[model samples]
Target: MPNIDATVTIPADATFDNTLQALRRSPLDFVSNLVQTHDDDIVRLPFGTQDIYLLNHPDFIRDVFVTKSSYFAKRKDISAEGSYLQQMSGVLPLFEGQLSTTYAPIMTEAAVNAHMRWDTMHQQRDFLKVDIYKEVMQITLDIVFKTLFKVDMQAKAADLVDAIITMDVGYGFDPIAALLNDLAPPVTVSMTSEAQAAHSYLLNFMLGLVEASRSAPLDSRSLFSWLLKQQVNGQPISDEQIADQALKIIFSMHEVTATTLSWVWYLLAEYPNVEAQLHTELTNILAGRTPTFEDLPYLPYTEMVLKEVRRLYPSVWIVGRFVRDNISFGRYLVPAGSIVVFSQYLMHRDHRYFVDPDQFDPLRWTQEAQAARPEFSYFPFSAGPRQCAGRDFAPTKDALVLATLAQHWQARLAPNQTLEPYPQKSFTPRYGIQMTLHRR
Candidate 1:
């Protein structure tokens, strides 16, 4: 641990500026290069006046999120507007009890319904050229919206897509933009007028859902109902608060689940051997039916593939946390109020933890293999109190979605398109994941 207290700064000059430009252009490549170039546990990046500490070492990351989790808090008011580009923590599910179980059937029906729609389209064209990004995002939106709110907004699905695109429109420049413009909001570009409009549309949509849930039966399973019924402090979560949080859930769930599923399809296309094993697991497990909660346990390989996909292309690449007072992790002391980041993308690929780090090998996710590693080394949904509230829901939902489609349809990458990961808030394919569908 050579001089852990000391730091290296990438200035606003040519070398560092070029990297910053690359970061804005291709964050996946930028940060990968940053980690490779720094080759140190902690790297200091200067974005105007704000100092960013990129903590790469697993132990250091553990200290930040778990071992000393209380020493850090989610950054408040990172952006002047727009839900921290849909990454803020307070606006999402607080993990009440057994949400995945309560929501499982809705999740299954949504996946099956998505397949039926594809099947209908496929009847007309032998091989449908579908954009996995769009389709998956739409399906997850349907799952979240319909399951929780008990309403269909299919007419506005296009608007939701627009919202996702525009909300994500300027994310890459957030770090630099925040600094230069004195916005100081990490990891988000300023909201565009278009994005603001879309945000308003979603808020209005969710507000309507909140109102509907107020009169909903006490036995209803809608998440909006759940939110309305619960009392925070002494009173129930407000309608405005409900609307704000509903939009946050809508933004986070649809984007993350959709992007992960899209990457799963892309990876399946690139690695046939892995795909074969996955299909075999589905075949032996489900035979020829849509997967549900019961079938998830037996479909271990399918879960492994999803795990591997998340490892390679995490839905959330990095999360921001404010350091609390004096903190000592190993030999380094991260001062309070400094912005520190721990990236799953970096740790998932760290050589010390993974062999053939870049390879998409699902077998590496075996129980024994997982048990051998440090707890924080592979936190795709994050860890500690701030860990994803949807942890149970996302995995089961992802496995079911993967199995539902992979069981009957084989989606291949469209030959002519450039299939590069877009490095968005989630790892989205830049050109969209265009695939030629084939019956399994």
Candidate 2:
């Protein structure tokens, strides 16, 4: 048994009313402040009858995700019937071994097509001034759609984008509700009418695609077609199962990559020095041509820029898992039935692992610099077996998209607007990024 002497629990009484007040104000800021103020590696926050333990050290994070992963459950109430999200999460692991081999060629083709589409848009002056976040979101939606279903979704992009945003807002995390649910099992949470509509529209949209594929000749290259042909216990998978996986893939591919690419443009505009280095590298490497999968190995600096953006603003900033059994971190014992949460936002910004953590420096990702830091100190896509299934695909897509656009144009931030990070399902800009594109 492990000793619990070193564990520190923040009281729930009036003395720490400020913590509760801060939490009400902004959960992200509250968690950040709590981690910084306490020196302990593990800090527990008591709410009602349960405790939420924040793991602040890298080793503890490793233990939760790697060393003792089986002792943690991804969802708090695993015994309950799995929701759509739960079903998606449970099914993702089945595709991990096949993602890189099956999707790399499709991603590369999509990236080249994205380049051609942008070139045509630029010729028509449509890329001159626009909301880049929305633009990238649409681009990613099209790319992911083609990659998954081998069909063009450009015609329905507008409706799909609207539905996606609605779904995000509708299903976005609510801390207060989460706390209540943990304190009391199976809380009946409600969604807005808009969210309900979005939910129905997205589900129907996916179902329609699945239905259409049943009669169409199967594309040897499409993930959707491949999934449709998959068998379990010698039986083909169900339409609902395929639809759920497709929806999950859409969210993973579109939202995360779009948010990262949006930040990439914003950061490049903010730091001309890094942008200059990137341009020089791209010019030297590709000489004004669209990049391919083969060009990736030569574009190390470009990858570094994407890495820095991921470090500064990870799409999935925080991840939480429920402790399945008593777990020990050094001398501290974390009891079963508690939620153990870790923040990539906090770990990436930690001063111990990074020098001037807030500064956007791509050189920090240099092999030498990376070797000097602890392995778990920087995990934007997370680590271990449960890491994102698209971990290999997202960066490749982001790099290609970034290389394609930056090769011919530079985005300048539009005048008179403040950019703030909104801690949504993905860390998105509260007000979308507005910019004017200048030909290079």
Candidate 3:
């Protein structure tokens, strides 16, 4: 393949330093601007001292993610060096299909629906709105514990949750130390020591859970028990591997769902009229009852609202893949071993697919409206075979939580406060969202 004219445009004002700074500070806004002014197919960004490529076009995204996934496995070169950041970097078998045959059934639509109502009932009884963030942490802990470990952490999971939250995502002290390590060799050893010290706290907690389960068979209802049955080429699963996969699934399921729901509440609080319409739909269909597996189809409007929020502020916003083989698309050819990224943040906001692009309109995602577009247009849960194994969980969880929460309580943003989306372990509120919950 010939090297096509680098048709990619670099903004005149977006210098290498400024571009990286922008990406670090606020990634969504940076990508949104590129989508507004530049073509969606490709844009080059310079981070620190390295050049990075950002791919936005759906066709290019499809080529990078679906049609060519084998050649582009998930790899994060930029953030993978730091131990504190590695917790957020590793991909589990769920995303890679290693656990598909073994683990998929537990997260089936019916199962997730059943789990969700239990969550909603508890949240309603607890008055979750005033303490929504903490409630999110508890729900994720319980869900992961019950689904994966077969044991309820119950009240004892607090220390474990605290440890998990302390894990970093590149920009914190770990990345800064890694940066120092690169700059000065003398201090590298100390930086590495500190990073390991921080990681040990979380690692030990996960290992302890694994050991406790072995001594006493909990419920045998979770992924942990399922792993106990698993054999790779005939060897039983080891404690180390179980710890990694368990920690992987536990954290993976927790933060993304937690932040997404936080943003859902933030969005609903931002728009009371949308909440009114959503409540109406839930009122008519659910009749002051909790949502079940059978009730979701009738709650299309509620689903649409959640989809719309996800489109605007997706939790897993930017996806990265390393190119293993040279692939050509249009005028550009990506060479083998090149790291490329496709931003859902940019593509979801592209004018070619969305009319206003920025407006939070749930109606735009109606079945008729969505069918009119290309298959790769919206990917909150990603696309193709490698998409999130837990995709079914989020929407089911959201529908149940949103619908049931609407029944007993109405909410709005506290005066003078608004949420700003930021990149964290996943897309998240830059500041904690504060809202006033009114009893309905």
Candidate 4:
């Protein structure tokens, strides 16, 4: 493997210090700046003893995520180890297969039920002002709980949501922390007290569900029941393992989907033309009725809008992998033990791939246009074998939710508020999106 040339390195001097400060202040902006400043497909950053390589081009991204995927592992030293879905990598096939089938109908029902709830609320008033993120989060939480555990979680929704939020804050990524971990011997990153408490609450909650399922009649459709049936070697998986898996699944399902849907609402409010076009399609197709999974195929524009939103504000904005072996991008070598990262944020907005990249245009997702772009250029769910387990489930739910909501109501951004993307555990709206809903 050949050494990377000086041109690819982001110099570790005053400029690097300034870049680190920029990173601490705003990681998204830091990455965006890096993309704009560096022309190379692979840019190297010096972090302590470790070299961090940012893969900018789709070809390089394809090599890391697909072709030479065996040479890399999820970077446990950074935040990848904390990822619930990543931790459950082995069961990804089950999620893609059996769990997807079980989840689809539940997701549709939940979407319809949410629409009905909004309908009941709309009866008292023609318009309502609400925080759209909170509204979407609650809906997604309910859907995840019912689908995963066959339990209605509405009553416990408030506390559960709080717990998740606390955990997110506790587990928020810090590059400095990561650098320290990289330089020092391996150690567990301690969660904040509040986050630990939240973790315990969630763990206990899942454990209770797992224990209850032990005595309850086994349902082939239930995720827990299915897990209980599985044997590792000759022994059945323990309650603790089942509970942990359930907790991870619940967290991954709700948070990512809710964040994505929240962005959809905010983006729609900001781009009325796109929203109008979406409403037109929904009206033409569903005719003021709720959408079902079957109706999603005919709702191409609705799907396009969701795709566009994801492209702009992907829930999982950044992915990191630890290089296990020397990997080459042409003549340049990314040495073993270095961290390789790719940003969906930067790739989706690259000028070479997307014309007027900042614009919220659903037309870019048309089959013809999509076919013209590199397959790795717009992966909001990441890519290859390790792509999101809920890839199929999420889009269907989002389209149905958006279609159902758009058929009857329009959400407008409230006046006098700045909308910014805060890249936390997920790309979240820094200030929650406040919107006024009108009867459409």
Candidate 5:
């Protein structure tokens, strides 16, 4: 019946150029400062040249991601025309839901192998002191490669993750590099030569897989090979397109899932009581058996712990989308081409939706609590048509890994390892979460 006022914040006497310079200096700090002194859920930030809006409530999130998602497009600054870049992206056919079901055994085997590797590491040293990031990345890479390409990435794992880390969020969001990556691609080669090499290496690796798959039998299980059998509109997608999709699938599947599991281990280590409960659940439900996809239905606490971990530290801390058409929110008019940003980090911690929002209480996810919350309030993998292609796959993989690892070992924080969340494209530990593995 009436218009609601939106909270607006801007730098005193700010200019566009100065805003860009400020963000370049420290994205994390700029964001942290933006939220200070905020009393409302919707905060409008006119950051230099960007029309940034951070939607902190579930109602706004539903307007952006689900109810009116068609009016928005995933942000593409690196691929925008006038922004010194121009490109579009696509993914392989296996990215859909039905194909995800095909990777059940692949996901389970990777978890088993990680346990074996932990044993090997422990035997080599009195106690296994390891970075959770390194171990989880290896397991994710193994599963992605094994399921998608049927290749063993064991020896090449280091190089692959190294490149992925750099590309995903290692170098914070840089507008300078964004423009240069488009206009003068050679600048990255000169300024970040090692990164360029890793990027090239991964590119060549994908091209090789596609080339090799061309000669393989028609019924091969590899996704690249499987793509060769399909026709789109009575014709097959081009090899180049398939290669692009191959790389897309690998990047999406490996980086985000691995990062999330690393955080999960860190959270488990921090909350010993929670870990004990988890260990009990696995022991009672699994009874010394390996975790399988069918075991997914039987592991309720495992699911709750995962849901809680994601609530605290969503891999996709914040995501931005470009409004394609003007949209209206409560007393707000979001114009076409403006950037609408939302943080899962903020919404998940909102005291309105969560009780003791900062506390790690997996019990908060009991059926009663879950049903009481609004739908879009807890979307770690996002929601709507453009939601994560691997949404179903990640939890399956996480449960399998958590079940298998908790079954055989308990991880405790090793001394001198300080864990802090570093927000990037995906949130990551500033330094990897270090822990000592205790065999069960």
Candidate 6:
């Protein structure tokens, strides 16, 4: 359209520097403001040749993540400049297609349907519902354990609960590994004690996981085991490959699931009416019992709530890609090598598609309402090929956790404490959310 290759330089002046500073201070709010301020699909950053193109509009998002997905691949390494932050959150080289193919059946809508049926009829016994946030966190941890290690770490759960609490602690925010991933081989830090500590901790932890998996007998259910059994033209996966994949799975699952659950409680507390309606739906459907996969079809309200939470606070809020070649979509062309971002936070909040976009209304997800909107307008887990591999399991687990906890308890935010959303590893509460659980 309008000179696709025409690019402008973003200087290291106050405008650019201050913006970066603001982002470091409050990334989510900063990005939200960025979305509102910039109209250009792509803006050149002082950072480098890799421009920051905002993919907030659904039409544009569909073009980037779905329609023209093959044109973009996950950025080889995220940050252009060297920083500790980018390393921690960089693209992980995990087994992609095989992992997706293996888990697809288990995480499918049908599998969810079957699991819910079994859960509702038989498996909900002895299940005293805990706080929804705690329950989801536990379930994610369980899933990670089963899928990654093929073993439940719960035998040591109580002790290990805090062990991995801040597993990514060494690299501050995004981690240096994520930043320098595509650069030269991993380098040692000589600057701060913090950096050194983080490097040591993560390296050791990864090494241990690798050693344990290698020594242990293979288990079919675990992801590591699945990888071990696989041969790429009769060659086994390398130790480094195994460790990297394991780290990716662990990091992705824990932070995202925990943060999503945190927002779930926050939203439920903010909207008493929605909570009441959700309770009514769950109670009417399950009749004072835990929800199962079968009840998912009947539990639209629960699904809506989870969808709403995701809309407001997507675990993987931003999808990043580096363009491999110039691509034309709609009226514009995104040149090769541009760093494109498709943001769920921006897309979900855009006024173009949603009515009263800022408000959190779960009812919009009702079959009738959803049917009325553009298909690509709703994408918390993204859309198309590179959409989250774990997207399918996330909602079912969220629904189960929410329904189970809501069945017996109502959790309320602690008095006089204001909790705001901020992006750390995931969408975490800027200040930790304190809640007092009242038994219902």
Task: Enumerate clash totals for all models, in the order shown.
Answer: 1, 0, 3, 0, 0, 18
**lDDT to native, each model:** 0.73, 0.76, 0.63, 0.76, 0.71, 0.60
The sequence of per-residue lDDT tens digits that candidate 3 reaches over residues 1-440 is 65574444556777766764565555667767776676546766544443456777778877766787666655334343233233322333323342233333333332244335445664677443343554456655665565445565755555665555545422143221221123211222232443465467666777887787788855444456665665666798788788877776776677677776777776777777888898888888978876665677888898899889888887677776656677766687666655576777777887889999988889988889999887787888876645676677667666666666667666566656555655644665545566656667
lDDT of model 5, residue 287: 89
User: Residues 302-341, candidate 4, lDDT per residue (tens digit)?
Assistant: 8899899899888788777778888788657888888787
Model number with the top lDDT? 2
lDDT of 6 by residue, 148-175 (tens): 4656454443333333443334334542
lDDT of 6: 0.60
Looking at model 6, report the run of 10 residues with the lowest lDDT sum: 84-93
Could you estimate the TM-score for every candidate? 0.83, 0.85, 0.75, 0.85, 0.84, 0.75
In the predicted model 1, the residue pairs found to clash are: 174-188
> Could you tell me how far off, in angstroms, the CA of residue 187 lies in candidate 3 after the best superposition?
13
Q: What is the lDDT of residue 79 in candidate 2?
A: 55
Model 1 residue runs over 4 Å out of place are 1-26, 47-50, 76-100, 152-159, 170-200, 214-221, 226-244
User: What does candidate 2's lDDT look like per residue over 175-236, in tens digits?
Assistant: 54443334323434567789889878888899899999888988766667667876666899
Candidate 2 global lDDT: 0.76
Q: Clashing residue pairs in candidate 3, if any? A: 40-57, 148-223, 148-224
Worst 10 residues of 2 by lDDT: 178-187
**Of 3 and 6, which scores higher on lDDT?**
3
How well does model 5 score by local distance difference test?
A: 0.71
